[model samples]
Target: MNDRTDAGGNPGPEQPGPEPTGPEHTGQPGQGAADGLARRAAAGFHRTEDGQVDVLRTVGGVRGLAESIVPGVVFLSAFTATQALNPSLVAALAVAAAFTVARLAQRTPLTQALAGLAGVVVCALVARSTGEAKDYYVPGFYTNAAYGTAMLLSIAVRWPFMGLVFGFIRGEGTHWRGDRRRQRAYAAATWAIVAVFAARLAVQLPLYFADQVQALGAARLVMGLPLYAMGLWLAWLISRPVAAAEGPRV
Candidate 1:
């Protein structure tokens, strides 16, 4: 049959208009990178409260990660090599000090470097005082326990620490806590942190008390970064939707 036509035998209305054009919604620049980073970074999913995936706010980059990891690694390696506490402590301390000085000289933020230094110094002092290689990890143990307790208690009181911290940073004050849904979401996120801390204690404390310094160090190393990243992911998962549900109003 002949093609359908108008009364004048012209092409029919079924002929399509020019292909639509303009900014695309799906293939936006950097979208693939954002998606990859969100899913892959630290082997966890991370995003912000705006329902947009991005880097986990908790994780620092390569240099910052190095600052945290290197000193501990040095301590573990030195102790394993020398089978002596003082030399290992000195090695870690020296590495931490070098990081701090490098940060200072570069005029960068001293937070991570100084934190590394303080941690090493405290562990060293503890080991020195206790005369045991294992007690070098004591401060970290108590720290995890304290944080775990505080976060769990905050959840019990219906004021999760994640909510408090996020709100303070956003200048939203305590208002988000007033929303029951948001509060519940934050509480879930807080529970993630509590889990992390609890896991650390459960894994590391036995090794600590057993004087298994190397095993404790290994546990701390494995748990610290990866678990913190997971907590960040949980925060984004639980809290972002709450914020999104509230919409852009506040």
Candidate 2:
């Protein structure tokens, strides 16, 4: 039978379903790499050994939070006070560099620090090239747009991206894709992510186009990590799979 479970709701012998084509589908030839990446991404949600989401660790605790927030704060402050692009950019880069150096000195994993520094450098260069303080946030806009589009496309393909990540978290693996209710739940969660990206553009684009640097900076800060964390929490709540008693059917 094609059902994930037998007619009476007891577990059936595992049988392969028609393989879907997408990053989230385990049927793909690149399934190994894709599953690994999905698991890694899922790990960031801080799913505990007991299946709980650790909000504090998921948001990277206090030090990680500071590293993410402080540079943008410094840049905004410097630009607002001096109205000079170069100094503000330099200050932001300096702060990011300091974080990286501290991470190195402390022998902590440099992944977050190095990534933050790379992002800061990109923003700094973009702003410097345009000689507009507001341009500092442009790269972020593109990033959100790209990620939103990709996730939306995944949903269109019937392989919702959240299912790939959250499935591993829930210990369901790609089998979640076989369950229609689980599929819908995950699709909804992925839409939540798309909404987060869309919200960033909808609110900030006007500010960006009007060249309102300070307000745009504030908006980016408000909408960036904080909004992302909230969205993730909501997704985690909304995407709970159907119970085995109500599991997938043919």
Candidate 2 residue pairs that clash: none
- Going through the candidates in the order shown, the clash numbers are 0, 0
Residues 143-193 of candidate 2 have per-residue lDDT tens digits of: 777788888999999888888777766656666777688899999999987
RMSD of 1: 19.8
How many collisions between residues are there in candidate 1?
0
Candidate 1 colliding pairs:
none
lDDT scores for all predictions?
0.61, 0.71
RMSD of each: 19.8, 10.8
Highest TM-score model number: 2
TM-score of each: 0.73, 0.82
Worst 10 residues of 1 by lDDT: 1-10
Task: Tell me the lDDT of model 1 at 100.
Answer: 84
The runs of at least 3 residues in candidate 2 whose Cα sits more than 4 Å from the true structure, single-residue gaps closed, are: 1-34, 242-250
